[model samples]
Target: MEIAGTLRTAREMGLVACTSCTRVWPAGTERCGRCGHRLHTRAPLALQRVWAWWLVGVIAYVPANLYPMLSTRTLVASQEATIIGGAVDLARHGNWGIALVILTASVAIPLGKFLAIAMLALGVRHGSALTGSRRQQLYQVVEYIGRWSMIDVFVVAILASLVQLGAVASVSPGPASLFFALSVIFTMLSAQSFDSRLIWDAEREGRRA
Candidate 1:
């Protein structure tokens, strides 16, 4: 069935969906017969969970910026650099490509995911000019790009592991590395916890009004 040319959602058609299996059952069914996954018309506490994880991610991000992400010890001296500081240092040395990659993966992607997830949450409740399909696409993009945020952490870890020269030189991950990794993880969780069905719900309600 279609309403105002919008296709009907499963919930409107009296069906429950298994998120894990992508199978639909009659509305009152308890679980998916094929996948044994519990069925719900929508995820419980979806928005609340997103906000909770988002808050923790934000908290972790504060320390991530304030602390050093890399620590180096050489026979002559010691040095440390935060994420942005390291990227800038790389750019100064004409390693512009590496600096750009670090900045984009560490800074731009994470911040963009945060903003996108927040907007998706708010849009579901209050509505927006974006169509339902556009909102869904934004959610998919958030989920897809989130894992790349770990590139900086992986680089730091690999460098730390490879550069152990006893007395000559050593590289170690700094406090900020842990915090940055945590922030990326929590934000990924936030993105996963969103209920995309709500996007269609909001659209349906808008058309009816």
Candidate 2:
């Protein structure tokens, strides 16, 4: 039995939830009987894994922006376009909607994910102005949107596949395409490495203090 308006977490009630199967068990349980996965009140080395993957993503993103994402060769001339430059060219060619989508998915969303994950990681470590529920929601959003970070890569791939006209005009993915893809992949790994339960633990500790 529990009281109304005074919610209690499973950890507070001497229970641990399996990270894999989401089954609840007593706190001292070493492994989940249902799934046979090792159980813990919180993920081990969660912050370290998050930061490591985040740093790699940031490193990859630099060259991804500086180098050319797409190389176009035509009988007349050759042109190379970076992520932003490609979007700008598209906009200049009156494809405003597509340009906007590319910018949002490639630039804005990835940057937001980096910042959000860093904030959540730091918040659990030191302290945060946001409430636990808010932090939880932020984490959920970061995880949910991570998969879409590859939109830029997919766009480049599609263009490369479609724009082959026997040397008259051919578009191909450049070096930045690989870096951009790695950035997206590492960013997703960073988001996945985060243990959202830490947010609740931090809140509990705050309440006790």
Candidate 3:
């Protein structure tokens, strides 16, 4: 836990940061003068919040995949399409690019996010074989790509708005849209709740006792 050389971290330099405003303050300063927020070097319950939101995301993701994602109404009849069904429909219509995008954003992305978040949480708990830089890049990737998962929702909204024709046909979002949106939101929150600083701490201090 001792730095043998001259290198030092903020903790070693005897500094603390305001969790709310992100303003650096002397370690002993009572509160952030600008924001009036209590200052701490780190979030008090980072991992707990991460896990809680992760579970919510996982639960929401189940229904999101299971239920219909889009509903269509025509003079003939009504049709409901789940995510996979929608993608397959797109592919059948020769819109393979759109179908591929939908699958990647809705299905592949959420699964990738779940795995990535799980790895990040577990990496710090169990000593990571990955270099800090590699792990940091992975974290950055996971954080950056999360917003793209809403492509399915956006597409449905756009179609619902643009394809409304009286007695001809109509498209609307279905039950799964809400759940998918919730899942993406919860996963984003879970990713934000993680403390990237802990990634380095494990390298310096070794695994938790």
Query: Which has the greatest TM-score?
Result: 1
Model 3 RMSD in Å is 3.5
Instruction: Summarize candidate 3's per-residue lDDT along 1-209 as a digit string, tens digits.
Output: 77636765567678877767867778888789889998767766988899999999999999998999899999999999999998999899999998998899998989999998998889988877788888899999989999999878898899999989978999988999999999999999999989888888887685334
Candidate models: Cα lDDT each:
0.92, 0.92, 0.88
Residues 1-209, candidate 2, lDDT per residue (tens digit)?
A: 65634787767788988989989899989999999999888888999999999999999999999999999999999999999999999999999999999999989998999999999999988999999999999999998898998888888899999999987999999999999999989999998989998988888888999
lDDT of 3: 0.88
The digit string of per-residue lDDT tens for model 1 on 29-110 reads: 9989999998889888999999999989989998999999999999999999999999999999999999999999989888
TM-score between candidate 3 and the true structure: 0.89
Ranking by TM-score: 1, 2, 3
Candidate 2 — which pairs collide? none
Q: Name the runs in model 3 displaced over 4 angstroms.
A: 1-5, 19-23, 28-30, 34-38, 206-209
Backbone clashes in model 3, listed as residue pairs: none
Candidate 2 residue 187 Cα shift, in angstroms, is: 1.0
